[model samples]
Target: MLGAPGPSPAEEPPGGGAASALSGLTTRGRSFLAAGFAAAVCSYVLGQADLLRVGLLLAVLPLVCVAVLRRTRYRVAGSRRLAPARVPAASETRVHLRVDNVSRMPTGLLMLQDRVPYVLGPRPRFVLDRVEPGGRREVSYRVRSDLRGRYPLGPLQLRLTDPFGMCELTRAFSSHDTLTVVPRVEPLPPVRLSGEATGYGEGRQRSPAHAGDDDVIPRGYRHGDDLRRIHWRSTARYGELMVRREEQPQKALCTVLLDTRRSAYRGAGPDSAFEWAVSAAASVSAHMLERGFQVRLLTDTGSSVPGPDGGGGLSGGGFDGAASLDTAGLLLDTLAVVDHSAEPGLSRAYDVLRGGQEGLLVGVFGELDAEQTGVVARMRHRSGAAVAFVLDPAAWSREGPADAGESEGGLRLLRENGWTVVPVAAGASLPELWRAAGDHRAAAGAPRGGAAAGHDHERA
Candidate 1:
């Protein structure tokens, strides 16, 4: 069924609706033939030979016309396109159909069979009214997408037949049309992403490794000021352009560390622990980009989702697929390909990235060993990157302390080092979590509140 189907359509119409058409035709054709034959019989019985001959010739003319038309071997043609152009999940889109009759003779009936993509269309069959020769017609139909990803439309088919129902012929059209249906994505309103690492652009300002603060903009070098950045030409022109000293904008970077270990992904419905990590990453990236920071993507899964075709992504900022690709699609694709295992590949990737240039590092994960905790703690204290672990309560089968499987100890270690820590959970709102984390990172350098830290914290 995925490829072309065999069989030139049935000589007779082939569908549930075909039965009615057959019945209607049988009754009408039989009536016409019987009336014509009765008139001929009357003329012959009355011994009017010439009149009877003329009647016979007139009666059989239409049957000969149908035979001739069928032998000529003409074809039917049509085109199809999906509209609104790009279709997203849960949204309705239309399909445009334009049909044309390419034969010299008119077609009274057309049994069209259009191939729809997976799960669309009322049925596989289409019923087209009479089409005039060399004439065109267009029509539209609506369809809804229940899932995400790409869909291809193709192969228009038309079955043509002549009037009087004496003979039938089938004509199939050849053309390919395709459309991609993306996943439904919610809008991002706030700038902060929870359960993500904070680099130079949290509430507090940070300087780049390669460059220090512009330090101060001259309000206008007073006679008593240091002559380090004096603009003599400006003083000669406006008496003083008054170069205002402002805090230099720090170059910032952020990376999302996701937890794809089987042990970490456990969560109840609407509480997928993995989802918390993705949403947190999206929120953080959006927020950081708005604040003029260079953002990078990192994941904690054994093998992170690679950029399309193993190609590295563009640097610094500007929405990648984040704008064109729905957030759900982004996360779902990540989840679909995530390898559920504990691979130290994450640590190696981190080291390679850090070796290039020292910047803030945000760590996202579910389980951390003593050594892993120390590494994250050292990264925050020594390199200025904080790690936030999205904990899920549903991970452990046993019930003990409410904080039994929590990452409180590791969080505390990062906090003491002046690195901000943000925890998230399903019970809280993403916006509220962001505000709380933003406030805490601003006021206390860490938010004590939780947003999506629970292991199984699932739901969108």
Candidate 2:
């Protein structure tokens, strides 16, 4: 989403003077003025014509330049464009600026500066010699940021000066635009969910004896029912038009539960273990959405992440004037701004998911306590298949590794109860983590096993 540009450099208090409204003389101009005034005053006191002439000349030059600058007209328009408007984190993006002289007169050398996020790169500056009426000048620069978020790109600043360089004028174009940096989505090799192996699929199921709910389960074919979804075998047996309902099944649905509790994660800023959790969640959500599963991203607070239109939920809003919501983009956008919650968010997440069962439950979490571990264990039991990417806060500690036994015990609990758990450390390879999760799918269905079936318990 785009936000308004902040107050420009030229903006000042209402009753400000001309000096405050515009740039004053350069150092050289001030130096000349001081020397001229000293010489002029000395010449008058000593009655020396040579010193008087020199002082007058020096002083007059700057005044002439200022007078000329006062009459100079500045009528120009500028526009900025960002190439590949959307990009993965840490990738380079191109920013181009075009300035056109719209006035009748030609302008002299002008300075252009474009402000960008500090993480993207240094602020870009350029020089244009001249631009005649209807003339255009173009400037281009590249920016890349390691973090994912929506950043404003423009509100170009232009510095105009007269030929003598005595007086300067600064104008700011308040036009603003945004650059969206989405999280990196790593592709996982084909992995079969445990429920898929257990024969839970999209095949027809026996309808309830009462009737089918129109908003949810499918019922017998009515007059306007589409024939394509008709279940011929059920129709033959019941001697009625048995149409397959389009209700979402536990097997066809996947929920990405993200732990965003501030108290649970360690370290700080974008490089913390919390960020790694966000990246992992984004990658898994994207992969599942691309695989055609009905995926939803839920925070530990039990609230769905805001979608493209700034609304919550998968079916709530669309972005970029899209006719339908783009699930992958929405998930990434939500992850871009996710912050740690003050309270224990996992409890609320468990409360939300407790009423309904899920197909595949993939959780990206930080260190959990005993009560939180029990909640996750209950969730695992309700889901057909469950996978957990657990971040070890001890790995983020600089005071050497703290006691990991508690965290280990939590992971042990999840694994003992048929949860595929992968311990994640800071800066761990996401593809490897995904592979580990895939390798342990068998363990998710195993009645009793170690933390993972075949994979070793490698931290990070």
Which predicted model would earn the best lDDT? 2
Tens digit of lDDT per residue, candidate 1, span 1-460? 0112233222323452334333333344545555667769988799888767766765665445444544544445566767775665567888888776676766676676666776665535667777777776777777776544456665666655556564344444445665555433334444343223243243332333323334353466666555655666666776864544444544444444565556555553223555555445555544555544445455543233234211133223333334223432344444423445666534654454445434445555655655666655555533444546445444432332245444677667767865566665544465565566556655653333344344336552
Q: How accurate is candidate 1 locally (lDDT)?
A: 0.51
RMSD each, Å: 12.2, 7.8
lDDT of 2 at 255: 76
**TM-score (C-alpha) between model 2 and the true structure:** 0.77
- The residue-by-residue lDDT of candidate 2 on 1-460, one tens digit each, is 0111234223223444455323457666667787889899999999999999999888877666665665676567788888988888879889989887877888887899988889888899999998998788998999998888899986788877777777665567777778888777787766766653225332121111122234454368889888898989888988988888775422145678889888878787567788778878888877765554556678888876543111223321111223124666667777877777987647777776776544577898887889989888888766767888887776775545556777778889998887889888667898888877876775444634564643455653
What are the models' TM-scores? 0.53, 0.77
Model 1 stretches with alpha carbons more than 4 Å out: 1-79, 84-89, 100-108, 111-125, 155-185, 188-252, 260-263, 266-293, 301-345, 356-407, 410-419, 446-460
**Pairs clashing in candidate 2?**
218-245
How many backbone clashes does every candidate have? 28, 1
Cα deviation in Å at residue 378, candidate 1? 6.1
lDDT of each: 0.51, 0.71
